[model samples]
Structure formats: structure tokens, C-alpha cells
Target: MTTTSEHTQSVATATPSRMLRYLPASALLIDAALMTLVGLVAIVGRRELDVFASSAQVEDQLVLAGPLMIVGWIATVALLGGYRRDVFGVGTDEYRRVLNASLLAAGVTGVVCYLARFDLSRGFFLLAYGLGVPSLILGRMALRRALHSARRRGLLRHRVLIAGSRAHIDEIARVLGREPWLGYEVIGALTPEYDLSEETATGVPVVGNADEATSLAKAYNADSIFFAGGAVGSSSQFRRAIWELEHESIQVVIAPSVTDISNERINIRPVGGLPLMHIEPPTWSDASRWGKRLFDLAGSLFLVLVFSPLFAFAALSVKLHDRGPVLFRQERIGKDGGRFACLKFRTMVVDAEARLNSLHEASGHSEGLFKMKDDPRITVPGRWLRRFSIDELPQLFNVVRGDMSLVGPRPPLLREVESYDVDTTRRLHVRPGMTGLWQVSGRSDLTWDEAIRLDLYYVDNWSMLQDISILTKTLGAVVSSRGAY
Candidate 1:
């Protein structure tokens, strides 16, 4: 006979509140309505151009298209997990899924139109696709901001229970603290060996042990239980805790030991009855090197061509403002401790280096790196240029010169490298990047440890996809202008 614990129900399994149920439905309705409106507008816009004129444009065909588009919108949302309650106010994942669904829907519509021999205007379809993608993402972003406002106002919040030792639970608490927009308030924690003196991490009460955790959850009405990485005594202890909590209908989230692992590198497979994790390291070989180099060269050339006007404008502005050289070249440590001339549009006074000696004490010495948050030597135009990263555009020339890759760790100053311990020296293994993990994340706001961790993580998990992601994020980072001196 199966034990009572083994036959128990799931936690957070209770029916969602009426408000919770309605919110997602409301979001889906809004999504569908926006898609239909955008699609109709696109169709009208296309018909104005001669490329979309057809015989059916008079009346009957126009009337029939509305219902078909609505149906398509609904189907797209369903396929894309739009109405899913969980992802409603979450991160970009929900929006990404919706965008993918729209693309798929557009593809299917194309195929069906082709198969049915219906004369659909290609221009109209393209307009709809173009509008639908941005509309979906923008709509979601707007909704997310609204939902975040509601959460801050204390309206739609999730009460959570965390399980594990103090150290593990503390990590979970800090993560939750960083994502208050997610609206998860820790109700309590469950630990096998409870210590009252150190009972709570992040001020959430330590309620009970594994056996009594279910009652504590019920009392707190927690939406879910987060299992932080820790031993659960025995297999039976783990099984028993899960069984007891299941009857209360709670969703259980097991936090794995893995952190800072790139999404591209991890794949899960089922082996017999157990789940196996497969981690494929980033491709870094002779062929990969060649491909990456080729990609960097081609992309740098394309960007240089496209942004030629902006580049010229920046150079002109610098020249007009100051009587010095437009380009700034510094000897910085590159890959494998090689020194390269890192180029930038000069943003500081020519005497900036000369004045550095007087300001050296102002730049604090921490981990052998000195940083001056407010250097007096920065020229007026230089301040604005550095803030928006306009000064860094000239790095494209460095990429062309084979001295730098488009993406990698930030180049360390020669003085900075001299101060590195054995571990920090690992960053020199790869070519220094124009913008990187730390630059996109926090830049100067990051402490030395966090900065090193980001660099090490990049070195450990570097990939073409990851590089692309960093480059994309760098665009936003430049716009935000955070942590720039």
C-alpha cells in the first residue's frame, strides 16, 4: 500500500482567485483586439498602394477578411501561450513567446493563402507582420508597467514559502528582493534544524520543519514553495514533504545549484525515470574562431557603412568643440596579455593624462584598480560623449584592425592588470571586448567581485549566441547611460 504522504495532493493547486483568473483573460482579449486593429490598419494601408489592388477590393472581400483575421489572432494567441496565467506580468519571456506566435501565424496564413489559391497581397502581409511584432512587444511592455504599478500598490501579490538551510534561503530572498516587480513576498521558511537566533533570512519568519511545512504554508496561504539547494535528510524526507504539501495545492519550484549558466548551454533529457542534464560548452575551436572572426569583420564593416553619417557627426562635433585630435588611442591589455591600441573618439582634454597625477589620490585604490567617479579633466563635450557611449564608436576600427573583437570582456588598463590576483588574470585569456557583461549589467555600480564574476562567467560560457545577446543588450545600456563617468 502506498503511504498517505505518497498519495497526497499538490501545493498551490487551489483554484485561482476570481481576480487572478480574469486578469489573464483580460490580457488575452486586449492582445487579440490590438492585433485585429493593427491587422485591419495594415490591410487598409497596403490597399492604398497599387501593389495591393485587387478585383475583390470593392465590398464582399473586405467584409469577409475581418472574421478570418480575428480567428487567426485568437489561434495565434493560444498557440503562443498568451492566455497562460503564470507568464502574464513576468519578464520578456511572455512577450517573446507572443511575438514568436505572431510570426508563426503569419507564416501559416501565407501557406494557407498559397494552397487555397487566394490572391493575397504580399505587401499587406508584410505590413501586418511588421506591425504585429512591435505591437505585441510594446503592448506587453505597457501591460507589464501597469501590472507593476498594481503590485507596488499592494494589489495582486504572491505570498511565497521558501525551504532550505539559512544560506540557501538567503540567496533566494536576495533574488526575490531584486525582483519586487514579480510581487513575491516571502511568507516563511522551512528548515529541518531551525535556529531561532538565525531563524529568518530577509525577515521572513522561519515557521517550521519539513513535516510541519504544509500547515505553515496553509496558515500563510502561500502561492508556492521554493526549494533552495540543500539536503532533505533522506529520499523519504523529500518525498514526504512534497506529498504533504501537494494536498494544499501549491506549486513547488526546486532551485538547482546552477547559477549564471547561459540558457543556450543547458538541455534537459529524460533518462529512464530520472532527468539528466546535458551541458554543451560553448563552441571554441579553430573553425569557431575563424567563423567568429569572419562574422566580426563582416558585421563591423556593415555597421561602419550604416552609421557612417553618425560617426562623421561625432568626429565633427569633437573637432568643433576642441582644438585637439579627434581620435584617442591608448595601449591596453588585449587577449593573452597582448597590448593593442584601443581606439575611441577623443572625449577628454588633451591635458587629461597630465592632470591625472594630481588626481591620482582622488581615484581610490581598491583591488589595485583606481576609479575616479568625477574627474575634473573631462571636457564639456567629453562628459556627454562618454555618458552615451558615443566616444566608443571608433572601436569599430579596432575590430577591423584585428586588435579587438566586437564583443568580449572590457579591456583592462595596464595599471589595472598589474594589480590582478591569479584569478583576475584569467580575464586576459580572451580578447578584450568593446562592451561586455559588466558594461551591460551595471558597469561602475558593480563591485570588484561582481565585475570579476561577470568576466569569469563570460570566459566560461562564451558563445556566438551569447555574444549576440550582449551586443543587443549593449544598445539599451548605451541608451540608459548608467554608470558612465
Candidate 2:
């Protein structure tokens, strides 16, 4: 055990660990390489360039100027915090920043070249920036994917020490446990001073009590410290804990009780020198539903036009396979207990519905949402259609006809709706969607409870932006066919 005094000393003298020490260098090099490549492409695409000062040769001028441009672009991105660990982690902010920085770099280059009378080719400059910014964004996305993969494998993780009530601490732990790619490796936890549990209910070991938090964090070399509910007795204790750990190279995060809320709904307001967090109520109203309906009308029509060929192909394939109707319309529970005929390409035998109960008994599926990995009723064309979600193409008609939205909860069957308890019925508040959070996040692989939670969340916190994002992700999900059976 590290003594309190030793921990105090270490806290005062702690420095950044070797973990991810080369990240900044790596980012710098990546940006430079992308910029250099774009510059060379611009030169070859537009060989006619103005002479630099007394240098009449375009190649000679570029040989000196290209590296300088690359260095400037990298410097601008660094200045704008594009390479920050937190910013680059979980959102589009990283890509946005890289784009902003690149555009700013382009503007600065143009301004400087004009002011200094450096005769630069307009075509070359335009080509360089037009290609460079998007290329840079793509590079960052690739880097982020690689980083996320590394994090999933337990590499480049932040060693975290949690402090809070056992309930809150374990809740936080469980969330981290689910999202391994977030790179938070829980080392141990600190509970309230009144309790003396060996570990949290979630099995996260208790290293110390709340009062020992600062010392324990230092002792463990924790790169990140989380303070949840019951972590500190009062505001003063929390302040003191913060003050003591201020010298250490550690990130202090307060995550006692927020979950499943989008960042768009959260804001901070300072009153009387105290920062109070405000959470907006969820969006759920008839007016909002209409707005979403309009969106669905437009989106579904666009999709139908674009994928009309696929529609014809799938219909013919399914019809040829079984000589059954190409379109399979099943009555699904829609908004507020309304019934709608949900459409799909016929992907199952004519007797698929009649066999549901027998299949359920055979599979021992006691869940509300029935799923089987290999159902015997699926026809040959149906199997291929389900793989890439081609079976769902006809739902575009559902969206256009107002029977569903472009994005909302998956239309449930009457039997499924009948099994809903009070809370589960909340999913009916919004129109059923052709694809939704349920589609992008695991699809058929999701548990009944998980699917319910996602649908309820979508119904409660409906937003146009969220719908658009889900639609974008749906394409990728369909292509990857993850969790699709």
C-alpha cells in the first residue's frame, strides 16, 4: 500500500505517462504526408504555374514551396486542436475541425501569396485545397477507425479509477464495460467512507473509500478519475479533492447520473458562480410527428426513385423462386395503436406466418421479439434479399403512404404489441420506421429489451438531425450486414 504522504508527493510530481506519447508525432506526420501528396497531385494536374521570384522553373519553385505548404497546413491543424485525444474520440467534431483548419490554411496561403507577390497558379491552389481538405478528413476517419480498433483490443486505454456510491460506480462501470472501444479501462473503485465493501455489485474491486480518492488515484497512476454520486460528502469535499489532484496529469470527469441523452439537449448555465447543468425535455408532440412525416415523405420518394431498379430485380427474383406475390404486406402496429400494412419483398415461404408458433416452440424463444438464426421457412431468394436488406425495399412505399416514417421505431407485429407492458407501449408514440436505431445498432441480433430501449429512446427524443444521422448509418449497416440474419 502506498502511504498517504507518498501519494501526496507523487500527485504533486506526476507527469504524463508513456501511453500514447507518440500520438502527436503520428498525427503531425500523417497530416504532412496527406498535404504533400495533394500538393504533388495538384502540380501534375496543373503543370502551368507562375515563377517564384527569380526562379523561372516551375519544378524548382515547387521543390522549395511544397514542403513549406505542408508544414504550414500541419501547424494550422495542430493550432486548432484537431489532434486532441478527447475531440478525436467519439464524434464528428474531429472531422469538422480538420476541415475548418484546412480551409483556414488555404485562406491564409492565398492571402500570404497575394500580399508577398508570390505568383502562384490559381488552378494549382484550388486543386490542392479542394482535394487536400477532403483527403485530410478521410485520413482522420481512417485513423479514428484504426484507433477505435486498437482500443477494442485494450491498447491505448485510459487507466480509470472510479469514486462514488456502489450503485453509481457500478452503473458507470457497466457502461464502460459495454463500450470497450471508448478505451476506458476501469482499474478499481473508491466507495463512500461509510461503506466497507470489497467490491461493487458489478465486481469492480473497491480500492479505498471516498476520502482516500485523491491518494488512491495517484497511487494507481490513474490517467482518468471519475467522480459519481456519493463520491464526495459535500461540495467542499469535491472541491478539495479536485484541488489536491490539480497538480497531477489526470482528467477529472463527473459522471454520476446522466445516460442515453444526446449532447444537443444538454447545456450549462452559470448562476451565482455555480455551473448548473440543464437538460431539455424530450421532443414528443403531434407537430413534431408531422415534421418527421414530411421528412419521411421526401426521403422515401427519393429512395424509391433511386432504388427502383433494385425493387424490380428483387420482386422478380422472389416471384420466380416461389411463384408467390412479390410484395408481402403484413399488418404491423403503427403509431398510437394504429394498424398499417408493412411491406417487404417476399423473403419467406407462403406459410411463414402459420409456422411462427411452431418455430417459436422449437427454438424455445420466449422473448417478445421473435428471431431465429436459420429459420426453415425462408426461400432461396429471400435468404439473399435479407442479407443486404433488399427485402426492406418495399417499405419505401410504406414511408410514402404515411404508414411509416423514414426513421422511427421498427413497425411491430400485433402479437409483439400485445405483449407490451406499460413502458414498452411508449414505442408506439411515434410512427414505425422502415429503418431506425434498431436497424443501425445490431438489427436482428439485438435483444428484445435492447431493441425496446433503443426504440423508446428514438420515440422520446426525436430529432431531424438524429434521423438523418441514423439514415446515413443505415447504409453502412446494410452493407456490413452486421447482426442481420
Candidate 3:
């Protein structure tokens, strides 16, 4: 059905389409080039060459060493699997690899130079390491943003064909649809014995049965095949299917039945020729807890000092608005069900609590948690303060006093805590936060279940990186004032 000229034209058109797959690799190469330029600038600015016998001699030596350093760095990154397809365009793993590779490159270069008796400027090397790593990270982050934007526009996504039962396919499809930044474009699904009219929950059409996955994947030009829980007939069948997919260079992702488990906690081990997944219990180690406390203390104290002027202004405004106390302190449940005085700027009338019973019917959040979009009790200054979350600034003092953290689950009122079931009480395992997954995600707009899920996710997967990400996102959340009444 194909003619020579037509086939050539089609090939030409397909060239650029194939090139898109290498975009991440190209970005990495560009990063390497930029890093090399930074190193060159550092070398020149430090007059690294002048430190040697003669400028000409040193220049000649540098001409050889400079390219070697760049090549070495790039090679180190490649060796560390920084250019792997899976690590690209998502997660902190790529950035971590880059940092590790850079450090290793620097150390290796230093050792090589010393052993070879080559005179090099220590300051220049130090400057290169300091500037290169951060600059590379920032560059990669910018590239990641660009990739995410492209993905949002329905570009640069992996063509995925889900192979599973109807329920399993639907579940994976829903998750993939929600997280577009993950870059999986579900073309269709190959379920086990699906009817011709069947479609996934997210409207992905059923193309074929599970046994026909490979043929369907090829027909659709799928880049990956996702196997949800109970997708294949048996373990042997699943293993064979994975081998076949790998042979065809298609990625295979297995979504085990385990839900809400962080990757860091899961380890794949082989025992007696069987691949077993070992899940580590959530970290409640003293070292981790102490580290969190130190971070909270340092971060909260710094924030308090930085916002002291705003604090003074807020206090004055509240005092001027009403002849009542500026600080509003309420008893809230904290870690291990302990009670603490949670402080905020007085946002409502002094007798606001006295009218709570009268407004309960109208509040709409009558089921344990209380949230009203518009309350008549709020003062004018308090409304503005709450809108930008300035009222919560007082909680930084709580953080400094060891009652809270910079990031964790939201602190619950004593009444709300009283209604919490056994599972919900797990939130009290760690200190509450000034800003948390709940605060940055949706704040007051989130339903109770959504809020609980996010809080549980944070508790299960608490890390310094996750905390930093939440804090960074909190600034945007505050600025937008979405769901902040």
C-alpha cells in the first residue's frame, strides 16, 4: 500500500516527531554546556592560569584541562544514570543525581590533579563547584517547568496502554488523568475480556483483552504498558509479559494493590529466586523527629524576626478596631492529644465565641469541623488578615516554643478532636504545623475526606524535601487566597 516517494515523505514528517522523545536528553546536554561555561568563567575570573609558572604555560595547560573537566563531568552524570528516561521531567531524583555527579566529579578532579602534580587554583575549583551545582539545578527546574507546561498542553507525554481488569484500568486511568504532570497519555486500555462497548471510568476506550496487550500496544504505538492490580492471570504470566514488553522496548509499570505508600519506604528484594517487596514502617525515629524540631525552631524563629514589623502593625490595627485584646488564644489539640494555646491575631469580635451556638445551623460545617465562608463576627481588619493568612503568623511563636512544626497536619480544635475516630487520631502522631499539606492544597475549601487523605499522605511520607516543597507552595496559596475566608 506504500509507494517509495510517499514513504520518504512520511519518514521526513516522522523525523521531528521522533526527535521530541529526546527533548529531556537535549536539555541535559544543554545543562552540561552551561555548566562548562560557568566553570570557564570561574577559571578566568579567578586568574587560575596566572597562578602557575607563566601565563602562557598555564594557558596551555588549561586548554587541555578545561575540556577534560567538562567531559569528565558529563561522563560522571551519564555514569550515575542522570540521563535515564524515567528520571527525566519529574521528581527530585534527577536533581539529586546531578548534585551527586557534580560532587563526585569535583572530588575526582581534585585527586587527579594532585596526583598528576598539576598546578590548579583551589579557589577556582571551589567557585566552579559552588556555582555549577546550584546553577545546574535551577536550570533543570526551569526545564522541568517548561516540560510541565508542554505536557499540560497535551504535548511531550508517553503514549500509555493500560492492561488490567475493568476496575483496575479505571482506577489507574483516574489517577493518571488527575496527575497530568506525570506525563502519561492514556490512549486506551486492554482489559481482560472487556465488552466491545466498555470504557474506563475516565472515558478511556477498551481496545482489546489483556492477552492481546502487546499487539494493541504496537498498533497504538504505546510507549508504556501499565499493569494494575490483578491485571494478568498469574505471576508467571505477568513476568513473561513484562519480558516481552521489555524486549520491544516498551516500559512496564506495575501498580501493586498497595495504596498511599511512598517509594522511599518500599524496597524490592529477591529471596529464594522470588522478587518480594519489603515495606519499611513509617519513620518515627528520634533522629528524624529531632531534625524536624530543629528545622521548625530555626525556621519559625527566623520568620518571627522577619515579620515582627507586620506583627506590630496587625496588633495595632486589631487594637484600634476594637477595644479588645489583639492576640486571640484558643486551646487546640496537639501531638499525642496534648492541649496547647494556639495563638492568632484577633480576627473576630471579642464575644464571637458566645454566638457560636446561634450560628451553628447556618455555618454549613456543623459536622465536627467548623468553617464559614462569611461570618458576621469578623472585624474589618481581621477579614483582610485572614484573607492573606497573616492572622496565622502568630503561630510561628508556637513553632519556636515546640508546640508545632513548619509543616505537618493542621491542628484540630478540642471539640473536633473529640469526634475523631481511631484512624483520624493518627494525625496527632506529629506536631501540627503553621502551614501544611492541607493549608497549601485547598485550605478551607477542601472536604474533610480530602483534607484527611492529604494529611495522612504527609504523615506517611514526611521528608525535608517535601516540607520545603509545601512551604514554597504555601506562599502561592496565600497570595491566591483561594478558599481562605
Q: How do all models score by TM-score? A: 0.79, 0.89, 0.84
Q: For model 1, how does the per-residue alpha-carbon lDDT over 1-485 read when each residue is reduced to its tens digit?
A: 64322322232344322355577777777778787787777777776765755665522444665568667867787777877878878755688788788878888888988898876667667777789778877887887788888877755767777888777887888777755777776656777664543355455556667556667777656777888766276657777888887777677777666766666678989887566878876433321287778988998999899889989888888899877999988899988899988899888889777876667655545453445677777778888888998889889989888778888878888988998889888788777778889899888877787888788778778888778999999989989988887
Indicate the residue-level lDDT of 472 in model 3: 99
Cα lDDT tens digits for candidate 2, 1-485: 86544543554455434567667677777888888888888877766543233334446667767777888888889888987867755877888888889989999999988998887777677889999998888888788788789898878888888899999998899889878888888878888878888777877777788888777877777889999988888899889988988988788999949877777778989999888999998775642456777877887889899999988898889889878888888899988899988888989999888999898888888757677888899899988899999998888888788888888888988988888899889888878888899999999988888888898888777788888899899999999999877
Q: What is the lDDT of residue 71 in candidate 2?
A: 82
lDDT, candidates in the order shown? 0.75, 0.82, 0.80
| Candidate 2: residue 374 Cα off by (Å) | 1.3
| Model 1, CA-based lDDT | 0.75
Off by over 4 Å in 3: 1-20, 48-59, 111-118, 194-197, 200-204, 247-249, 284-291, 350-377, 400-402, 479-483
TM-score of 1: 0.79
Top-down lDDT ranking: 2, 3, 1
Best by TM-score: 2
lDDT of 3 by residue, 233-267 (tens): 88888877877676686778887667667788889
Worst 10 residues of 3 by lDDT: 8-17
lDDT-better candidate, 1 vs 2: 2
